[model samples]
Target chain A: MTGYIEKKHTFRSWVIEKLFMGKTIKEYLKGLITPFNFVAALILLVGVPVSVYRFTQGIGPSTNLSDNNPWGLWIGFDVLAGVALAAGGFVMGTAVYLFGLKEYHPTVRPAVLTGFLGYFFVVVGLCFDLGRPWRLPYPMFVSVGVTSVLLLVGWHVALYLATQFVEFCPALFEWLGLKNFRKWVIKLTVGATIFGAILSTLHQSALGALFLLTPGKLHPLWYSSFLPVFFLISAIVAGISMVIFESMLSHRVFGNRINHQGVDFDKLTLGLGKAAAIGLFAYFALKWVGVAHDNRWDLLNTPLGHWFLVEVFIFVFFPCLLFTWAVRKSNAALVRFASIITVIGIIINRINVAIVGLNWNLEDRYFPHWMEFAVTITIITVGVLTFRWIVNRMPVLYEHPEYKEIDQ
Target chain B: MEISRRKFLKSISAASGASLVSKSQFAHGAERFTGWPERFGILTDITRCVGCRSCEAACNEINKLPAPKIPFEDQSVFEKIRRTDAQIYTVVNRYPNPKPGGPAVYVKKQCMHCDEPACASACLVKAFKKTQEGPVIYNKDVCIGCRYCMTACPFYVPAYEYDEPFKPEVKKCTMCFERISKDGIPACVEACPMEAMTFGKRSDLIRVARKRVIEQPDIYIDHIYGEHEIGGTSWLYISGVPFEKIGFRMDLGTTPYAELTKGFLGAVPLVLILWPAFLIGVYMFTRRRQEMVETEAENFEIEEDQQ
Candidate 1:
């Protein structure tokens, strides 16, 4: 009887150890680093010095800012473009978890995690460009301008960050093998997911509304009263495209996880392709309407007008048509290419709005300094590192069928 | 369960249709209204300006702004057109020829003090305010040094104190709100040797501007520069030449600058209030159908096992 009791105790301990800690720290680190770390590290080495120079010497010293133009690549590419691209994770999270599309469950964890990290980096990028980042919270607590679009953006970004964190908590719970807590989190997922979706819609549009306040400063071709709506819709397209791009990237970089989970990349890609097509179609129609509403057809004859047409036709129109064709054909490769083009289109649109379109008549335009580029790169490196850290420990890309079976 | 699936599909279709309808309605609604009224403003008359630089001198003295590269008395300063900087709050620029053979034209460079002043609207913190007395003022104490207001300003009036290490703020024309409140003229207006920079109620300024344009049509542009530009600025201008030729933006249109974002801003509350309920309803509708189907499947399995 004594021997049997000892044996039973040892077996129980073994089960606990296996379930609670799937892999040792060393093993987890090895899995996390994957070849991607080297590329991220190389990018960081160049990015760190640039960021330091920006803080010490000021933005004017490092960037091409002038009295005629103030905003540059930092605001245009890193903050605006980066934020739009990250919209994918939230859009996917809403479709799968909130809408109870069980087929999309496998994509939810990674998508939300990506969304969370993407936004986190966007805030970091913004802080770097802000002349006084130390006083950032003044907008949140000390003085609130409820009427301003930026105030809405500031609040929404904060709230959405918290929402994304909650949305991603279940993955962490699963990684820890905390079945009871994980179950509780799963129950709240629907609420958190929906809340995130709502916040994403508001803030993404608010980013565009921030530009609307400068109607005279921005070029007539880009300026529109419907700027917020345009931004919100474009973000939807950007988000879907970003997910497709990231998924393809993950498939290449972390094939082990994809293989382990037996993820149906073909089906996932198809679904995303469909979403991209719909979003692009709507966005294209709106672009035309925006031009029409402003009656800016006369501008098309000028050089600046021609540039606007190029941005719309080559970047927006082409990619949108490509997305539709790729989705209908169920061609994953074609869809992936279209997704990349769509992301490029978003970048072009944002850059045009923030930089190219601003002070169009001025002979001098603001160009970003090397230091600004460095800081942008550094922030991106940090985002990549954070993503690696989360994916390493969390069950973000894997299924824990054992946990589900045990609960049953 | 089958019927519930159909109902869920129907609801989704209806909801999507509603979203489309609302989107079109939003587009129409935005185009209908011009912009908000009761906006702060300023007016400058180019024809009345005499290149005395008294407004520039007074602005520097009152704001405690730093001295300029060129002394106020140096008549040669008129040879080169200058812009406002962190140190200078205002400048008077001279156009060498007003009407090809006429005397030199002088236009003051300061904040336009737009009707829906974009700087005030853009500031995240309530640092910038559109005072009822037709001045857009900045509160440095509340500023976080974001410089978004600088970016948003159509006229690029606000300049950042980038050289300051610990504390920095946006510097711009405040329309002398403190003096105006005390029933005094703005320092610039008071110091103007030619009465070029007029100080009066916005309503009176418009009337004065119209009289000047109507009295001497050849000496002034028929259009008042700020009366309708960007929803009417506090400082109005009447130029002998086209305003565009004399460095004014002609494309600003009559709508208040801030009105551009009104449709989106107004929609924010509506979205905030409605989106959650709309999404939750969809969630519950989907979840309930899933549960009913699961329960039916479970009941069938149990009956089979019992048999």
Candidate 2:
């Protein structure tokens, strides 16, 4: 009875705060008119219409996708690259929850939030790319293709999105000022974390397995039997690097919102950088192992071979070395710079596997049409804006003071 | 509980630096279906092909496809290489015969319809199917139009209706599924004036191809294309010149693409089984520590109250 009354009172109070939060609401609205929002608005302006054009006119007009090249930047960048970029959730969840690293708690909620939003948009982009997006459920509820790697990808991503939502519910409950609901949600933390970790491991690798059927089509340098393993390894670094990278940006952009005294973000960056250094080092070693196992030494002599070297040495290896140097010296700025390169390396690797490295010998290379670029940029812009909105509204970046004991 | 950088590095490497898995030991799970033993198939002898477009015209008429801009009787259509599209399910392309004086060789290309079709394996909705009669058929009602089958097809046979805004589908050769299953031959086979194409049981066709190769070693290539490529296809080819010279990919291995992904899929069950137990154990350990901390905090508060 007391719990019911308390919930009702808090619900009423929450409504009052939203309707008339005094200058707080006005200040947030005023803050939205920055130069950054202008660029985002401009992208949506063009991109929204282009997406509408794609739907009405068909994928032919909006994309450079051909019978020769069925998949383009939308699948390559928006879905594949976006899913990888969102790896921070499982990586941090595993580090803090499973490994018992209490020091990493402050970073956990943001990582989970990033992951949920990232996957949510991957589905959005996937729906756009599909010819009949409405029938997507046929693979799930209607008729399951047991042998399909893509089927595994679809089911696992859907489940993982839900799991991440549940994993982040404590923050949501607190935002709603539902004390009893928040306490109920906190009890589900351990199960949800484990479930998220399992799904993360599967779907992350399943995305790579989606290309396994196209072994002859994907370039020899990229195609390997160990693609799933490689994807999982690189995703770990992608996750760690993304957290280090995102938190650095979050600290700069949302400086006032952060509890700077409580959480020393500089130290956090260096710590995350240390973990990423190890992952990147392993990822580099494994990539060569894939090449050697495939006996692609002859490919190293070709022009694409040189390009592969650039991807490895410059983007992957150099950032790894920089991470080590930064961690050893506790150079937060250099670590931040290395994280940016690591993010770039992840993007290049995904694009290389999906686009450039695929059909490398074909005469006609597929370059995304201008509209394709607009759609991809728009999807990314929407993800960023949504992330900013949640961070501003919810208890994502900082721990809610009311529930400090539980979350902290 | 300060974590030493060296210990953390050791753990990180131990986790992500596990031994690399090689393809040599990997088994593609194609053993589940050895394929219908008595399945019917087509064998094409390129040496006998006359570069006539009668088969193409017959296919267009029988499938009720849109009429071609260049009528089938026009010999000028063979001036350039052509690919099959939504309007046509098959096309014959002329290539210069290896010998200088002989007539130009013509090759008819369509869906290979593998014994274990990759399209069937890749479709998440089970839209593409390999039938008992050997034709790779499709169920349009179940298809989500993801175009993954196009990516999976090594032959690049499947085409899409990019012009259709609302209800597009994957268009490909059905190997005359409607006609062949009903005691009738494919329209293309019946329309072949030179009698270059032969259709029969896959095993019988292989033996027939071997006999032809042995009888005319000088005139035909000893090896039959698609006999073992991608774990054998229903469509077989024999040509006097090298298969590669006429745009055939010699690189597609005998190991079926389905088998290639089985190793990854095989590991999936193990992960799903092991992850929960391991994670829950970790969760228990972490929860125990939290309980201890809570109890210690409670004791400290009681001590303060006594003071």
Per-model C-alpha lDDT, please? 0.79, 0.88
DockQ of model 1, rounded to 2 decimals: 0.40
Across B222-274, the per-residue lDDT of candidate 2 in tens digits comes to 88998899999999999999998888998998888888788888899999999
Alpha carbon deviation, residue A400, candidate 2 (Å): 1.2
Candidate number achieving the greatest lDDT relative to the actual structure: 2
For candidate 1, chain B by itself scores a TM value of 0.79
Worst 10 residues of 1 chain B by lDDT: B32-41
Docking level of model 1: acceptable
Candidate 1 at residue A232, lDDT? 91
Which candidate should be chosen as best, given TM-score against the real structure? 2
